[model samples]
Target: MKILLTAINSKFVHSNLAVRYLKAFTKDMDYDCKIREFSINDREEKILEEIIKESPNVVAFSTYIWNIEMIKRLSNLIKLVDENIEILYGGPEVSYDSQNILRELNGDYIIEGEGEKTYREFVEYKLQERSLEDIRGLYYKKDNNIFFNGKRPLMNMNEVVFPYEEDENLDNKIVYYESSRGCPFNCSYCLSSTIHGVRFLDIERVKKELSYFIKKEVRLVKFVDRTFNCNHKFTMAIWEFLINQDTKTQFHFEISADLLKDAELELLRKAPKDRFQFEVGVQTTNDEVLNRINRFVNFSDIKEKVDELLKLRNIKQHLDLIAGLPGEDYNSFKRSFNDVYSIKPEEIQLGFLKLLRGASIREEAVAYGMKFSPYPPYEILKTKDLSYEELLKLKKVEEMVDKYYNSQKFNNIINYLVKQFDNPFDFYYELGKYFDKKGYFNRNIGNSEYYKVFLDFNMEILKGDKDILNELLRFDYLNFNKKRGIPDFIGRSIKRGEEEEIKNMLRHKYSFKEYYLESFEIDIQTFLKDSIIIKKKDYYLFGYGGDIIHITEEIKEY
Candidate 1:
């Protein structure tokens, strides 16, 4: 059998790892696998023509909320060209309402839960000319009838193949794998329910996967698991293995700080700094808001664990908060913000509550009198508890988070001066509010305008607070928006710091080859030396098309 695994990613930058998993799962199976990825950049007609030409025995689509509508359109178009081609849809987006999705997408077969065994079963049945509706993990629509054998008892992951063990060298690719599935916490506006429940993949198998990347010299491995810290034993085992290996390859995991045990913290502390990054969804600290959304939070413990981790100075900890959530009015949101802000994470990702499809909260949104956009994301416009005007105010605050908080360019300045207020949210909120009134922060700026705004904003931040002026001088260029000549040039090695911001300013002004000579590392000496000019010396520079050096920050101050 021939299979076409297509993934239409939500964005250009993100690679579609599902197809890689499909290819790995079907490696030994009797089939010809062709992996094709499409994005907003790809021409639609060209992709459609290719699909029409290569009418394979099976067509699999990995679904997500962002690409569902597009997937439906593509599936319809594919059916128009070849109706007999077997279409199967899986992934979180369709895992919840398999029957409806099967009918709607005109899919002959749908795999719920893990795709390895279920997808293999799909191919085997088709190859042997057997009825697929009887497959344990499959939901199928045939003879104008829908059949579901219910979900397969989630795969014994040990029996499964490694997600990237095939003919292709994945060293160049930013590989993603899950040590576990399902989230333990059931935050109301979350898709944890849709995934059914948590089942950890084999740790040894996960290590083997990591081992491959180590041997292959892949620089980064991003764990797609939700709440990586949920399973203490599993988390420890994986972290212990990678730490012991001492490979240059780094691993990124999203964890729940509240659930992180002391032992887990110790294990994490042992890992090489900058090699591991954790994103904790500290949605809100307001107890009422948390309870309204069915979230169980140990605020005190969460604070201590996060702060301790921040003190580690090795790992990058990104803490998150949601602006629009149930029981969170303007004042309540500010309290939540300030509470989270007090911890002072390396990065604060200000996000809005996206009342996603198949989420528990969306079901009871009416009870909360929530007015939300009727879309895949279904973001809350406002709830009875929170007015629309206040939500709009929160939007401005979110903009501030993106610019100063999340972008992290203003970290030095923020840390230096934002100390007078007890509530950090009030401090940030007031800052964002002040900027909007000044007409300094605009959505229309491009290149030169961007720096003008950045510098101007930083200068304003310094005038009222002189303590932050020196902090502003230690700029990391990478924190600003940047585009390079080569996509995936540095991949995960690049951090949003001065190096990147400097690189961006150069590339936008010149070209890559113009500044790039030898490979460069951004150190303090190089940063200050590069501040002056050096010609005739051919060496790698820090920024794109610039000279290279790595000097510590203290030297510049001295």
Candidate 2:
């Protein structure tokens, strides 16, 4: 039997490890398997034609909320091309309630939980033309009877193969990996509902993966586990491997700061600069609101510990704040926002609650007067303190935060101009209101409209000249990030430098043009190695000159 395991990802940076896992641990000697990947840009007709030519007996497709609609449409097209082909669905979006989805979409079977062992067993049975009703963790129908094989047991993670063995070059800027299977916390608004228990993959196996990534000089490893620090022993061993990896690779983890111990904090603080980034979900600072959401984080401990980590100046902090929750009224939210703001994190990520399909909260949303969009995201309409109008205003606020606050471009400008704000969110809110009132968010307003409106807004607020307006605009567009603050953009962070010196092959800091030209004897390739970014316009420089002075135009590479 020939089986093609397919996973459609958003981009090359995204590798569906679950599909890789399914391929790695098939445990079937009677079948041959091929792994195929598809992205949004890939030609669907060509792909289907190619698959039809191969004539695989079975095709297993991984599903996720983001890719379901596209997958369904493609599945329909595939069925048209080859009606005899067997189709199976697995992964996050393949509801445990697959009876409904299968009835509507006409898939052969839908597998729930871990697919490795069950997938192999089902494949073996199929090879011998055996009955499908006995396959556990899958849903299938025959005539008027429907059967759901009982849930499949979890796989022995340690015995699984490293999915990247076939990936010739692991030289991506951002690659994701999982060290665990489930989340420990029962955050109501999360997909941890279906798989409520936590299970760890082998530490030695994880260390080997780290070695593989480090050998290829992978710049970033985004740990997709919900709470990396949930299992301290497993987490610490992984951290130790990362610390001693003898490579300049950076790692990112979404850890629960409230649960981190002193030793974890110490190890994190001691890590190399630009080597680690931690994204902490502070959801809300209001104790009652936190309790109402069935989230178990201690806001006080989160603030204290995360603040300590931020002070290390090594581990970059990305703090999150959710806009809509059960009891967080606008005022109460203001307090929560201000409370977290007091720590001055590197990045303040503001997101509205997404009512996911399998979250515990969605089941109870009706009781809390929550109205959500009936789509993949299922975003909340409004929760008690956050009214519809207020949420609309907050939506605009989200735009401003993405544009100004989170971008860190409005840092010095806001500090210099915003006097009435009690916290950073206040500054963002006021700016959002300004942009909304000026019709800046209108689709009809083009780039020129945006420049004009923002130019006017800045001048009025800053009481400054064209230079300051240009600076504010430049701050937003340039690749030179203050990363954590406003002192720099892509340009040099020189203050009060009124004199210019005649320079040759000038190295204007982050400018890619100069670096590319070997202005600093920097192998624009080796100096950057795999960590380099290819963007449009200027790389990250204010100005560079050999004889004539020229500014970078725009980013265009990647």
Candidate 3:
């Protein structure tokens, strides 16, 4: 029988590892199984036409919260095109509540839980080599009734084959790897909380699998493990293996900052700059909220470990804070935001709470008086402690953070501006309000417009020091973009032959052929072509055309 596996990703760059794993697991089967991937942004008609052209007897969809609505519509359309096409649903979205999903959608069968072994067995049953009743973790319709065999046992990590070797073309895709299968902590909002204890793959096998990406020079490989450092020994083995590899591939991990040990920190310090990145979930600093959500974390300890990591300055840290959780009001969330903001991570992901199906928090949502949108990605609308209006305010603040703080384009200006306020959160909150008031959020604006808008916002508040703000914004602009003429809004400092003087000063400092100054990390040639001289308190030359680096300290009075 012809079989086709489909994945609808949130973005074009995301490659679904689940479909790849399933296809790899059933490779030895005689059935012809092929995989097709599409993004949620793709037209439904285009996907439907492609699936019909495949003309497969069986089509299994990899489902998730982001793509469930589309899958529901696509599944119905596929059946309408051909009544005989047997549709199967799998992945975390359909893995739980198999019977309900089968009732809700036009799916003929549902594969619950881990599907590697179950799918292989299902393929065997389809070929008439085995009985349908014996296949575990499957919900199927026979004659007129639906049946679930039972929950499947967790498969051994080693039994699963590497997912990428079968297909070679992975250009511009973020490779997803899983060095372990489960989590030790019971964070109520997460799906990993439903599964107890961590199951690690063989460390040597993991190293071998990682070697493929290292050799391919994949841009990024994000580990899907929840709390990657739950097991110190297992985690360290992979970390150590990766550290020794002479590769440029960056690895990302979701880790608990509080779990970091002295040895782990020491090892991380030796890692190459930008070789490793960590995403730590600091949901809230309120102990009551933490206890209510079943997330037991000592914020002080987390801050300490994060501080140690910050000192290293090699590994990039992405700190996350969920805005809506039990007992966390807007004020409490502001505190949470400020607390994480103080740490100064490379990224502060200000996310809202989502009540995922099968997660412990979804069940406890009612008791906590939580209301969320009844749809895929069940985002929190209101909690007992937080109003819908307050949540919307936080949403505005989130937008401001994404544009200014996380973009790294306005680093110097943001660092300077936030100091003028009581706390960082208030500055972002006020900026967010300003954006909403000026009708800027609805318009599609360019980078120059953003600088102008930010300047206008600051002019309203910081009545004193307009020139300094203008120069700071100008410096921030030159730091990021090529030497586009300084915008009219951001006044220029260097004028009337100062450019030649600066060039002559640079020539006097370095050899004729030497273009790079190591201390400032600036190339004299590019600096001359794509840079501007601005003065805040002292004359400063800002370079562009590469990464955004601050040369504030390296500036000397000219």
Best by TM-score: 3
* Candidate 3: tens digits of C-alpha lDDT, residues 142-254: 77789999999998888997888734887799999998999888988989888888888899889988999988889999999988998989878888888999999999999
lDDT of 1 by residue, 63-134 (tens): 887777777878888887788887888887888777877877766777776777777777778788456665
Query: Which has the higher TM-score value, candidate number 1 or candidate number 2?
Result: 2
lDDT of 2 by residue, 1-558 (tens): 788888788886666777777776763465788888777667778667767777888888899877777778778887887788888898877765677878777568888867777787788788775557778888876775667878777776676666666455656636778788788877788777457788788888888787888888887888888899998898788887687657788899998898889888788766778788899999899888888777766788888898788788988888998988876788877777778767878777778888876777877787778888877667888875578888887787678766655656445444434444566667677677878777667756533344454556655653555454444344433323222322222233323331122122233434434422201111122222342323322323333342222232222211
- Candidate 2 residue 339 Cα shift, in angstroms, is 2.8
Among all windows of ten consecutive residues in candidate 1, which has the lowest summed lDDT? Answer: 531-540
Candidate 2 residue 312 Cα shift, in angstroms, is 0.9
Ranking by TM-score: 3, 2, 1
Taken over the whole model, the C-alpha lDDT of each candidate is 0.69, 0.69, 0.84
- Cα RMSD for candidates in order: 8.8, 8.7, 4.3
